[model samples]
Target: MHERLSFFVKRDSALHHLNPLTKIVLALSIILVSIFSPWYWTSHGLLLVVIVPLVFIGKVANEYFTSALRLILPAAGFIFFMQAFFQPIGQTVIFNFWFLDITQESLLFAFRIATRITVMISAFTLFLLTTHPSELMSDLTRRGLPPQFAYVIISTLQILPQMQAKAQTIIAAQRSRGLDTESTFFKRIGSVVPLVSPLVFGSLVEVEERAIAIEARGFTSKKAKTSLYEISDRSSDKFIRWGLVILVIISIVLKLWLS
Candidate 1:
């Protein structure tokens, strides 16, 4: 069997064995609490106290940190710099340059937003690193999620990597054919059309092929299909999910009360 394309790393750990829905709830709870909490440092606290430790508990610390440094930090850092300079939320200027000034309030606001984004991405990264996408879909499908909805979720998760791989292949082929992709800025911009045309067309053809293949496998059939692997949703999983729900409620209440 061909291995599935996903962020999942195979390992034995408490976090890995938790029900996929429980992990989903856990990630969402972290994100919601960080976003809705009244305290300015809530996101930073969650990142340090909860998400970081969970990375170790899941036994994927090295992989998680690699992904954070490679992908998550750059995205969050960009947002931080943009919001710090352009948010225009406060008047107490702390630093000034020709046309750009950093106010104390803006800095604080940007820090909160950046940290919230970091917590959000890190929690989801942890979830994906631990939970297999197929397993997640199977659990959701067994729990009464519509087959089409589950398939959409699975597709969304897997598409980006597929597209990225496809783009690289296309770029390599173009370079082999004497395409000028790296010489100058305008040449790079001009090369984008050639790269994009094939990528878009190829992706469309792939979608059609996948649709035909799934249809042949009875994707539209109403009969219950069996999963090759069983997903466990133990009592502990339910308890954890409920606890996350409670935490989310508390955060929302606190935000409202403080407001």
Candidate 2:
């Protein structure tokens, strides 16, 4: 599972060389545009055109699509069912079944919501695949974030692999003890409860141990903290950062004028 998370494109592309802060800002801007724009075709078309090129730039377009489908399809299904049956919109009803009505507006609304979520997820996936977690944390620290915050972010990334290994070990151990996770739906879920308890408990203990270790190492001292990696603001990164800002302004103006 962690291997899937490591589904990144390793390349010496311009997107890879960009500072994480630039990517984060640009991704967030795209997300904002998708969310705040009117749930209509014009707004979504703009986002689609803008983000499609990022796939080529990041060189993880295939993985990005897979990741988006893994998350977005199920979410879209839920939205479709809910909006179609429960919150039907529009003056004209297309279908009526018992107490539920499906309207054209509801369908369009669901599609809009699903597309918006897909775009946002794709943006984040591109960011994750293109930017290293360590570099992102370092960028955050350099941008006036607390050192402890950066440490937490970096630790989370490091812990994910450990957690995956521990989970697999726990599952195998439980299976040896006759707890079958491949059993019926409820039974499988029930098996997971016991299998996961030890992992969660172990993580809690590990966190405490890490906290103590940090304290022992004087991590909370008043002295400035030094990082192994330093974040430098390159000219190209600055140019892209400013360019994204301009694009965001243009997007907002277009939205206001068109809407």
Candidate 3:
């Protein structure tokens, strides 16, 4: 269950070894192009031609697939379904149920939007799977990102797993104490107070503990701090980042001209 919340997968592969900034740029590039490109099939092509192959190349195919099935697909599916039913765009209605109707044009539009969302999510997933959060934060800090901002980003990435773990622990403890979480709907809703109270308080305690811990480590010191690990930015990483930038520029130009 904790692994489900943790996105980074340790693997020995070229994709995993790439500079974290390069991976960030790569993910952003895919997302920008997918959203901005005028071509209807751009997202589909990116998923098949780029994202899928990168998963295997990163040696994180299993983890990526699991994340996609559990999280990404459900989200995109919800968006697709909502847009298909609720979007009042187009006249050729193919299916109608009371106030909800699915038109041919609306269906196509929903598919395009959902596919673009999938592509964006998949790109970020791939990056997270290959690049550890610490490495990414450290690299960004070295590249002129303020440490305060870097700490915030890393904390955001890590806090979800911590909160999930805490929630599970609280739920288990409550279950052992005869809490009725498995009862009817209202009973379950009532049981949530017992579960959430501890989780929220525990999280607040943790935040206080972390603040003290960081302060003790001279987190606010003006002196330059050294990293335990030296992050590399090789020529290849630079080349890839530049190429991605050029592609993004081209995508913007194409969208402008075509639109």
The top-ranked prediction according to TM-score is 1
Each prediction's whole-model lDDT (CA): 0.91, 0.77, 0.91
lDDT of 3 by residue, 1-259 (tens): 3343447889899998899999999999999999899999999999999999999999998999999999999999999999999999999999999999999999999999999999999999999889888888898889888899988877776678878888888999999999999979999999989999998887887888899999999999988788999988899999999999999999999999988
CA lDDT, candidate 2, residue 210: 93
Q: Write the per-residue lDDT of candidate 1 for residues 125-241, one digit (tens) a residue.
A: 999999988888899989999999988877776787778888999999999999999999999999999999999988888888899999998999999989899888899889999
Worst 10 residues of 1 by lDDT: 1-10
Give candidate 1's error at residue 50 in angstroms: 1.1
Give the TM-score (vs. native) of candidate 3.
0.87
What's the CA error at residue 186 for candidate 3, in Å?
3.2
What TM-score against the true fold does each predicted structure earn?
0.87, 0.82, 0.87
Q: Which candidate, 1 or 2, has the higher TM-score? A: 1
- Relative to the unseen true structure, what is the C-alpha lDDT of residue 135 in candidate 1, on a scale of 0 to 100? 89
Flag regions of model 3 displaced more than 4 Å.
1-5, 156-165, 168-179, 205-209
Any runs in candidate 2 off by more than 4 Å, and if so which? 1-7, 179-193, 230-232, 246-259
RMSD (Å) of each candidate, 1 decimal: 2.5, 3.2, 2.7
